[model samples]
Target: MKYSIISILLSLITLFFSIKINLETLIDYLSTDGKSQAFHGLIELKYLYKYYFLILSFLSSLFLVFAFKINELKPFKHSAAFILILGIVSVFTAFWKWFI
Candidate 1:
């Protein structure tokens, strides 16, 4: 039960990192000219956020596995699995932006 709760929480956190871009970053990125160093920096930061998504996805996957094996986690098993799958898909579909 506790494992499931933690798994669900971590899965959500991973999903959050996958999609949590602020308007300020976009505004800054759009406002800067292509030749500006700030433009490159902002782009780099956005890619860095994706790196976090990968790391968290890995951790969340582990928790989901543990939770899935436990009988006590029956109530939350589906939700935990679903959210974790969503987080992973966020990474795979980054180029396509299929589901942010």
Candidate 2:
């Protein structure tokens, strides 16, 4: 019960950060002149953010696993998993933007 609540809270926090990163990315993209390596660099950064979020989410899953298996520290595992999934999706979207 406690673990579930904690997971939800952590997930919310992770979501907040994810959105923050996205907004910042958008602002950065808009601020840049649409030309040259700067564009590429921004795209790359976007890709990187996806990967980073995915990893963090995965880590959150691991935290949940640890909480369950260890029976102590269970608060963050599910949150991590959720974040990982979100990151995976974000990456996919970014790839689509890049390729098409």
Best by TM-score: 1
Provide the TM-score for each candidate, comma-separated. 0.64, 0.50
Q: Taking the tens digit of each residue's C-alpha lDDT, what string does model 2 give over 32-84?
A: 56584355554656436444555555555655665676565433555545655
User: What does candidate 1 score in Cα RMSD to the true structure?
Assistant: 4.3
The alpha-carbon lDDT assigned to residue 74 of candidate 2 equals 37
lDDT of each: 0.66, 0.53
The sequence of per-residue lDDT tens digits that candidate 1 reaches over residues 1-100 is: 7777787788788677656543334455556686874455546455555656677667777777787666654668788888888878765554322222
Clashing pairs in 1: none
Instruction: Show model 1 residue runs off by greater than 4 Å.
Output: 22-46, 95-100
Strongest candidate by lDDT: 1
> Which regions of candidate 2 fall more than 4 Å away from where they truly are?
36-38, 41-43, 46-56, 59-100
